[model samples]
Target: MTTRVIAVGGADAAAARLAACLGGTVCPLAQRRFPDGEHYLRVLGAVEGADVVLVAHLHPVDPLLVDIVFLADALRELGARQVGLVVPYLAYMRQDRRFQPGEAVTSVSFARLLSRSVDWLATVDPHLHRHAALSAIYSVPALAVPSAPAIARWIRAEVPDAVVVGPDEESGQWVDEVARLAGCPGITGRKLRHGDRSVEITWPALQPWRGRPAVLVDDIVSSGQTLVTALQGLGAQGLQAAACVVVHGLFEQDAAQRLQAAGASRLVVCNTLPQPGLPLIDVLGDLAEAAARLIAPRQG
Candidate 1:
């Protein structure tokens, strides 16, 4: 079965790598911005009557989402049998629910929108806080492809003597998985949320990590506030680490510099966002491999 690869704007390098690995025809979609600030997307090649896999990663106000929906609808109209969405990093996931009055649960709404538009959905390390199962949250078949194993392999090769540490209790599960793969001990911090919904992070259990090369692991690093707080807390306890490893490196508002100033020796992340000052570990290979396995010819 022949597959056609369509990569929308973000993470072009990673997308290209995945397309090369899949041996699929790469169709580069051009993104243009109107003088009035609107967006334009153009599919460069023929997509009629083909199985199209749309690859893109969501950044702050990502234009890729708009393009994905358009591409999916166009492909279907042009005779596409199936449309597969492979988003390395899913945005608006943090707003999965609305606590206050009159707010949009962008995650669910976005999931529904994408579900109706495509046949299958795949993403990595989505900000799933309270969802018992992601499949239950989406009307379509949703899969969470973790980058922990890949991150672990890279950390093991680079920082051989590092311990995995979760910046907060929320990151415990991922830390455990990464620790297991990296063959290192792991620790999760205790967190206290204030009335303002601000967090007071503490790693009281990090006493044993005082002199070890520790690695802080998490799914997202938005403002770097959490990491800065964690690193300061670690310092207060005289706990020091080797580096930090994050899955989705948003690095908003100079978060990377903030983490460094807070004492992160090194920052390692997958090539999901085109942020500055970090190594781009290609995650598309893992994503494409998983997609290939999942969409493989159904056995009789």
Candidate 2:
């Protein structure tokens, strides 16, 4: 029996690449939107008695979580023996804890729901803090894939004398990994928030980038607030703006436009999350390799 891979809809190019690497079939699934803005999804491929992998990114799409759950149930009903959930950008992971009294921890709740829906889960650069673990939250076989190699390769190809900047302390780990791979200098700046929801990112003084390019590396870009602020800060120091790289491109409405307006020269993000008209560097090769490693032992 051969393993099968399918994408639930959004961008098909990356999915097709991943399936090609995995020696799997890229089956079809259909989605119909009604007048009321409701989405109807149907899986058109036969997953019965097969090992199935569903590749999707939970970003800029309505009813993604609900749709994945539907597919899980439908696949089970169709006699699929195993299901792997590969969501490049996992949603609701920032809400892993309750911020205040009577607040619901949506991250853990979503994890629990996903755990029950699929047999194994894989995600890239999840916003997991100190209190949470991917496997612990999902209560299943979980894998955390980092985009350091991909981001590093992109930096080497694009930026000149780029200093990898981590906007906040939390991002230092990933920034360090990417910087090491790129053979570039890296720094983690101090960040403080006045309110529970806002932050100020401070950049350090760098002499090598006096007239050179610099890249900002981070896991997620939401609302483009932090990045815009960082770019402004970097420009204040007279450093030439190069590019911005992120794993999850959760750009809010006009976020890309706003960032470009705020003086960011180029924005680069992986196909993990679709960003229309942006410079997309696909990471399907990394993910396909990861899946191959995970399935190797099981297949043996």
Candidate 3:
């Protein structure tokens, strides 16, 4: 029972790395749009009777969702035995619940849509909130890969005399874990959001870490406003040097620039997504191991 790794658009490099790790072949998927704005997807290799792993990072969620559906259905139609997903950055996770009346739970709906196509799912550090785990919404066997160990290792190797800081209270757990692993002090700040791009961040007492480098860690940096606010607050506190570390760097538009402008000394992200300019820490080894386990038969 051989498993083949297929890379969807924008996921080619990570998929190739995963294929090498899994000792599987890389299958290419091509996409095109019709004149009226419909999508056409084609799997360029034979998948007949083979276990297939579709690697995609669900940023730019709408089009990628359609692509995954079309590709998975196509593979099944071509007689593929099992189809699994390796989504490094699982989107639609933020909308786990409705904030107002008459609103849809998009997370559950997205999970159902994905569950219909894949036998099992694997992703790196999904933005899980208001739910304990992926199993809450996704019926399929879902694995949430932790990038903390990897991030900690990167911090240890790169940042010296670093004090780990979480941008908001919600990130305290990850910050504490990473700091423990890196053998550094950890502190979390308070965040109040007014709108999509408006955020207020108040840092905790950093008297103990004054003059030491601050490493701000978080799961996702979508709009980067949170980080910008945090960095500005730190600078006002006389913390001159700061680094931003994240699992997913969905730096929308000039987000990276904004963070830099706000005085972030360095920006590092895991290779979960295709971050072209910033430094990337490899997470493919972890993802490949998870994918391999998903394809393996369970021992009862």
Mark the regions of model 1 whose C-alpha exceeds 4 Å error after superposition.
194-198, 297-300
Model 3 C-alpha lDDT per residue in residues 1-300, reported as the tens digit of each score: 767888886788888888898888898777889999999888888899788999887878798888889888999999898999999889988887889998889999999999998999999988887889999999999999989899899889988578899989888878999999999888899999999999898877778777888899999998999999988888778675558998899999999999988888899999888888889988889988998898886311
Q: Give a tens-digit lDDT track for model 2, residues 72-124.
A: 88888988878887888888877777789999998888888989999888778
Best by TM-score: 3
Q: Model 3: residues >4 Å from true position, as ranges?
A: 298-300
Error of 2 at 196 (Å): 8.8
Q: Write the per-residue lDDT of candidate 1 for residues 1-300, one digit (tens) a residue.
A: 567787777656666777778777777678888999787777777777666788877775456677788888888887776788888888877776788889998878888888888878778888888766678668866678888888888878987777788878789889999999999888888877663325688665666767777788888888877877787777777667578788899887678898899898888787767756677666777788777765564211
* TM-score versus the correct structure, for each prediction: 0.91, 0.91, 0.96
lDDT comparing candidate 2 with the true structure: 0.80
Residue 59 alpha-carbon offset, candidate 2, angstroms:
1.6
Q: Supply the TM-score for candidate 1.
A: 0.91
Which of the predicted structures, 1 or 3, would earn the higher lDDT when compared with the native? 3
The positional error of residue 110 in candidate 1, measured at the CA in angstroms, is 0.9
Q: List clashing residue pairs in candidate 1.
A: none
